[model samples]
Target chain A: MADAKERKILVAVDDGLESLYALSWSLHNLVSQTSNDTIILIYAKPPRTVNTSPDGYLFSPDMMASVDKCRNDLASSIIEKAKKICREQGDKEVKVEVIIESGDPRDVICQAADKIHADVLVMGSHGYGLIKRAFLGSVSNHCAQNVKCPVLIVKKPKSSSSATGTK
Target chain B: MADAKERKILVAVDDGLESLYALSWSLHNLVSQTSNDTIILIYAKPPRTVNTSPDGYLFSPDMMASVDKCRNDLASSIIEKAKKICREQGDKEVKVEVIIESGDPRDVICQAADKIHADVLVMGSHGYGLIKRAFLGSVSNHCAQNVKCPVLIVKKPKSSSSATGTK
Candidate 1:
């Protein structure tokens, strides 16, 4: 039997409504099922670009700082929104932590799950089919395969009107 | 660019309405988009249990045969049904095949994808949460993680009645 008191739930967030649905669903379905649990929201920063010079040098300090600031701002806003949602739906005693990591999204998520010993990973599938995903692989798929813990993939509901739309 | 003529699609089927939805969705979406694509329905047989006896180590022939028959019946029926749906939806040139292998469903699906060089994998997510999934591990998550190809997880819409019931 699982000890709800020790359960840790991790949600991987992307900039999309589907991810938001997953967050809300996690709070409603997973959190409501147990009185004692913790929810952690994670946002993975995009990779930093290095400009190569003729002499094999990278970007200067000023350029690096500007890029870092942009990443921090983006990560902070996402975490703030997730925190607001958790506060609204989470239990008073349930702990909620916001994690911002920089690296490949899938790698960051899997590393965090392992480091924290997460009980489960909750994420949403953005419905990228083979060809589209061939060029841009899915992070959710990567995390699901590599993580030792159980993973819950939330699928976005299909609209009855059309087969394709913004997920 | 994706060669609509050379795409191979793998559909994972189980004993659930959601699996049926996945099957239908794959045919409607993939077949309608391509005429050269091949659809393979791979059914992973349930694991067999071993029993020890005083006389000798004997296999459970009866149980094994029964399970095999059921799997064959399911694979054939689903393929026929899928083909019929494709024809009804005005896609008549798509080729479909059935494959039944015995092992873990996730492993079987991944192996089939690799063997066939599948372009995409289509499966269904039940949307079970952290605790429920902890108790009952999800096969969709397993496939998403292990398969090399992109996976499309179909979500069934929550009925309005069920939504109200929850509230």
Candidate 2:
């Protein structure tokens, strides 16, 4: 029934405290216990490097293999951490799906949200001050600009005594 | 009585379509019909200028009064528009309040949210890309970092079909 249908929420995740806090906030504030909500977790990685070797240098498959393995391991751990948080939240009706894409996050997040027809796209801000963000750029801001759905960029409360912090 | 508590939601509104859509989204998606939700609408205006005249002239009291009246009228219209939206939506339990503040938004917003002990602070993002935001800065971004509560920045969706129209 349409009244009982699940609301799909796409949340961008990384292995950071802010992202974890966002996930926590969603579980308590946004996610409904009986609504069978679907939460899509996405983590974006850089594209594979196949660039030409430096001058007088040759490509090394052995080194490349190790680098690939390291990257894969990190991705696995990060996804696992997110999965564990979802489980701990104990929302029996909520469904969580993990996706790891190779590309810039600014592009991947918007595309994924569009493909999923997400009700809302959630993320956590890095909270970089004015000067720092100018140089590094903000993925949440980019997703907000390009995505076709609503974007929620959660920031951790600045004080320990904040209402959000108590929860 | 405690269970039917009023949730303080501070929404920063402007003349932009994005901000209007944000107000719409909140009424539909965030505000609970069953609970008593208090919506605080804040409009930030530039501080009244008593600066030295550009042509090295003196300040005129009559000119200043007229300028202040113009600003006040503008603020009244914007707040009335927001209130009309709420009334049209017909959520009887929700209470709407209006506030007009002067000086820098980056500072005023965070301070107001803190003083209100707001449960959540909502606003609309202009969605400037990385380079533009770096040089120009963002009021919502700054409030997200400094406020003690969670911040929700709603961006106008890219497609015309979405509730929020593109620039």
Q: Which candidate ranks first by DockQ, i.e. highest?
A: 2
Model 1 chain A, poorest ten-residue lDDT window? A158-167
Instruction: State the weakest 10-residue window (summed lDDT) of model 1 chain B.
Output: B158-167
Please state the error at residue B137 of candidate 1 in Å. 18
Over A1-167, each residue of candidate 2 has an lDDT whose tens digit, in order, gives 11244667888877566676777667655664334578888887656756346674655888777778887887788788777777776335468998889877777888999898888788888623345447648877777667877777777655533213224
Over A1-167, each residue of candidate 1 has an lDDT whose tens digit, in order, gives 11234567798876665666666656644553323567889887877745665699877988878878987897888778777777765434457888887777778899999899876677767623445447658767776667765566655444422211112
lDDT of 2 at B137: 88
Q: Give candidate 1's error at residue B133 in angstroms.
A: 22
Residue A62 CA error for candidate 1 (Å)? Answer: 2.3
Candidate DockQ scores, in order: 0.03, 0.24
> How would the docking of model 1 be graded?
incorrect
Give the per-residue lDDT of model 1 (tens digit) for B25-112: 5554334332366777777765554443457766477766777687678667765665565455423456777787877776788899
